[model samples]
Target: MKWLGVLLAVAVAVIVIYKVNYPSYSYRYRLQVSIAVDEKIYTGSSVIEVVWDCGPKIAGLGRCAPSLGGPATLIDLGAHGVIVATLRSGENISPTPDGAIDAVWLCASAFGYRSTNEELPALPHLTGRRNLSVSNLPRLVWFVNPADMKSAQKVTFLNVASVFDPTAHFTEAFVEITRDPIVVDIPNKLPWFSELRRLQKEGKGTLSKSGQFQLVYNMFVGENS
Candidate 1:
């Protein structure tokens, strides 16, 4: 009888904490990242947990957590383009108020279309395995949805090259979707690598150098209860 009472109390506490702390709506996004370098391909994956925050339903909504600095980074939710969240990366890099996300996606697209009408070299491409012709960067747009809490999401520096500085190297990239995040180790010859090797041997793909490529893919699992 005593043990049953204790179990019930603990269960109630857990529910309360989750309700208060976790976002009203949340989803787990699994991202598989990979790259093509020097005719070889290497890959890895990261899990992005996202939360949405819906501020007061009013026009010209005021900023959240002003003392923390300025307004949190905001992105447009896909459907209505509803603005959401003060975005931050898993590394705690706070999102900038500027439209950096849009800019990065833009630059990630076609290159050499200049403001001055001069010909320039094109930018590297981010391809989708299922749809290779167009850039796969749009897959990342889901992050803009608002959540009450921040997701532990990570986007590698290489992909962020468009928005961030120190631009260098041309690389072909793709994302292989997954239900959950995977830990890819190079030395152990994991299952993922086995497939990579098979692809390479069959002339379907190239082997990636260690730490050369980052694989990221995502699936929208059901919302939090």
Candidate 2:
């Protein structure tokens, strides 16, 4: 009986040690987004590269790729398509298209004061934080329950109709500040996929509900929307 009690104590001690050490062994990531573009469902490995500096102390920092969840779009802004009975060529100069990153990136990019050395071809200064600012809050951060994709049926896109005062300035140095595609890989049975059904019925486009969601938000922020 004494031996049994000793063994039990040892087992309990081991369990306690494990419980205390588990967090140390695990990775504590910085970013997580329930929203992902490209209609991708969220999985364990979804990631997006983001900038992390606005001023000097925060200058040239790259945020770790973030984890993401489902149902967004891959926006090809210059995508050649038939629009309003015309072969419309997408805009070139002083132009901003519509779409979103994983929700976390969007929130940080718009709301968080940060930037990176990451530069795009057309807009090399895309990460310039000296003048970047988020003038308003959109639907990204509100009630972000992983299981609520249903109520989020329709997605919208808004373009910045005009290029005016920039919170930051991108040097016109052959940089392309194009938005990257937000991608996440999730299993078929993630939380809240039922929301997609309602999205399909109410979405603005037939392509996919998440696709519409990306576009609609981009449009709502038209030019800057």
Candidate 3:
């Protein structure tokens, strides 16, 4: 009787511990994007559907494209709409490199609101959402109408990656620029935003308002096949 009682106590203790700790954990997000192409004028709307924590292996995913890190604009000029979504899994990584894949290139440009002549703030950021806990979708440089001034926008240059490596494939799903706002999911709360912003405040990123942020380096945004 004593042995049986001890065994039952251990089982109860294990069950109680698991039940109490399980609720504290958060779930993963499975991002799914839907793209539509206009084919007539190279523009459209993108529907991004997301499913949480549904993955076989998280790292096994690929860059937006099979090889191209992502998109300079991420919009398929041929298609009207584009969708981008991410998933979470057990440390997924691509096993094979797509023949059409290329390195992620850092590109830059000036931002300004055309009609109002309002310029954007040059804020420094840690980069994409890769490992961070939260993703940040900042406004990119572009022209907008005065009446369209909804928010004081800020965005540096966009890093455009080519999948074709000047010799392969470059495919876009689809999208509309003026209408479709830039929506990028960064990692959770990043560790570098505060410091990067501090640099921006200290005028360390660039001295001139027009002075662009220099290309720090090309990060390998590679995904497994």
Candidate 4:
């Protein structure tokens, strides 16, 4: 009886340690991209999931880290497409008090270099910080290649649209961020099975809804590739 009690205590301690160090919390969002070439537009979207794991700190030596999940192929414009565009979400994860995402770094780039061997001019590129909680939802950020502008100027949220010329030789890009809801379904297997069954009993089981930020962009390619 004493040996059985000892084994049970050790098993309980091991479970507690595993739950503390191995379990992870995650935040998910979607990234969508659209490119316009001539009269047709090509669009694609992918889910961006960030998982945070709290590591065991050995004398304060270890730190928590975040892992990102998404499709390996972001989007394939097409074989005959004139423009190539990409959207990337930063790995920096900082959640708000209400468990929502606070802010994230977003970067977008669009160019027409893939379709031609000719050395094209500078393309549209932008990297900026987006505040999700306090800022207005569905905010738009625009970018224009410096080669298209006659005068050198910085693009801001208010004056970015003015810099873009519809008849330019290069491509112009516009990125927007919006709040969308996503449903996360926990699988009934391994460590999550017990938690899933518990939630199932409360009618909150298989699926849980969470907020997601949809980062969508539109890139317009001019004729001169």
Tens digits of lDDT, candidate 2, 1-225: 999999999999998765443311101112222222233322121223332222222334322232222222221112111001000111122121332233323434442423222321112233422222233112221112333333323222122111211221211111112344433322132243234333444763322233333212222111110
Query: On a 0 to 1 TM-score scale, where does candidate 3 land against the true structure?
Result: 0.21
- Candidate 4's residue-wise lDDT over 124-204, tens digit each? 221222322222112222212212211212222223234432321212223233234432221211123345445555766
lDDT of 3 by residue, 132-151 (tens): 11112211221122122121
Better of 1 and 3 by TM-score: 1
Go through the candidates in order and give the C-alpha RMSD of each one to the true structure.
19.1, 17.3, 19.8, 20.1
Off by over 4 Å in 1: 1-23, 53-225
Q: Global CA lDDT of candidate 2, please?
A: 0.27
lDDT preference between candidates 3 and 4, better one: 4
Number of the candidate with higher lDDT, 1 or 3: 1
* All candidates: TM-score: 0.27, 0.22, 0.21, 0.34
Better of 1 and 4 by TM-score: 4
Q: Which window of 10 residues has the lowest lDDT sum in candidate 1?
A: 216-225
Q: Model 3: how far is 56 from its true place, Å? A: 30
Better of 2 and 3 by lDDT: 2
RMSD of 3: 19.8
Order the candidate numbers by lDDT, best to worst: 4, 1, 2, 3
Ranking by TM-score: 4, 1, 2, 3
lDDT of 1: 0.29
